[model samples]
Target: MTAPGTDAPSTSAQDDVLFTGVVVYSTQDPEASAVLVSGGMVAWIGPTETAEGLHPGARRIDATGCLLTPGFVDCLPTADGAAVDDAWRASAASRGITGAVPGSAGIREGMRVLSPVAEPLPLKDLSAQGVPLAFGSLGAEDALDPWSWVRAAAHGGDPAQRISDRAAFLASTRAGLRLLDVPHPGALNLGVEATLVVWEPWDFTVHSSDIRTNAWSVDPRSRTPMLPDLTEGAPRALRTLVRGEIVHDVPGALG
Candidate 1:
């Protein structure tokens, strides 16, 4: 029988990737310290030393002295200019944002939409280009509703799987940010797609950005690296992954 409060019941050795030497933040553990990924989903999570024995064949990536978390999921208000699609994606990837739900009024290149389009071709094109499709009604016109949307979705789910407000509003790249009644909006659980991000811890010696905003200190909302309102100055994204693929990676981020 599986022991209570332990993830051994779901552990498996077929994972494709293993991340070690970093602190993993998830709905299951605030700092799990290690994560195992397989087939674009998180297979298991626990201590770093124990991970190797679980998946010996997995590709090990060292994240020494860094903070590991889910990649950011941007809400509405992305630019619709096709000419700047690459630039927009680069900027978002640099900031640890792996997916986005653009405003309905504009057609932003490479954006994932909350609601499905009437035409199947457009949806297929986006998916072919690596965009995730989900359902919802979050529009740019309804700006004030997002605050409540963020709160309800992040904190109102199963206690163990309830995602941090930061992760739900900032690091959830799976689309479907338009409703308030969904279950576990952004919880990081086993068998879920491995969309992840890494951030370098700030030491007194390193030259880190000091872009402090009101959101950081606020109780339910910490100004994580990937909030849409955060225009300038924040911790670096370091690395990002979508469906276990390296969507963005900077020098020294893997280590």
Candidate 2:
């Protein structure tokens, strides 16, 4: 879980970073103005002034005009013969994935590609390495089929059905895998490791009305793009953190 030129923020008093002027999508609340990270956890969250006052010595990450949300957690199963390498990690980082399942992959020679099978995933070991592990089909593109089906059923249809579909997708993204019996997965809760992603939408404004009435628009800033927009690509991942360590910070991506 290490990246070149990126080290975990220290636990010392001077290591704190007051991340201010961004919309924080914490699990505790759907939104916050700021988040203070210390020792790889969210120490506090509030207005910019309060966060600055509480940690005067902390470095400031001015997140003005940005939208921050929990990092994407991908539970990818390793190809039995292909060792996980820097390329994969780099690719994941590019997609706003800071933490993943099976942090390390095994190596075997003479195979071009390997298929995923229904084997017991190393959830505990990966979690130990700070991977936000989950069960189910991370390796399959159709893993989101169920979500899509429900969403389609809700489209221009019953309001109750839309709400149910939306709730299900949110749970699937956040904590449903654990409910289905995956062990030791990460979550965006206070006191947990600081593994989160910040996104900046290209053209869309994540409106307050949409969050309440539109089931399809769950956190429009999310890089995953809960709502499929054929006209525009999903939001950009401005920053990604694993255990409060900056894994990806795209310069000039957000302004």
Best by TM-score: 2
Off by over 4 Å in 2: 5-14, 77-83, 102-187, 201-231, 252-255
Worst ten in a row by lDDT for model 2: 108-117
Off by over 4 Å in 1: 1-15, 76-84, 104-185, 203-233
True lDDT of residue 113, candidate 1 = 44
Model 1 lDDT per residue over 11-129, tens place: 23234777787655555654466778887788888888788998789778787666665665454443463423655555666666655554552233333444221212243244346
Q: Residue 207 of candidate 2: its Cα lDDT? A: 24
TM-scores of the models, in the order given: 0.52, 0.57
lDDT of 2 by residue, 135-187 (tens): 22346654322223223322323333222333322323444234324332233
Worst ten in a row by lDDT for model 1: 202-211
Root-mean-square deviation per candidate: 14.2, 10.3
Q: Which candidate is the best by lDDT?
A: 1
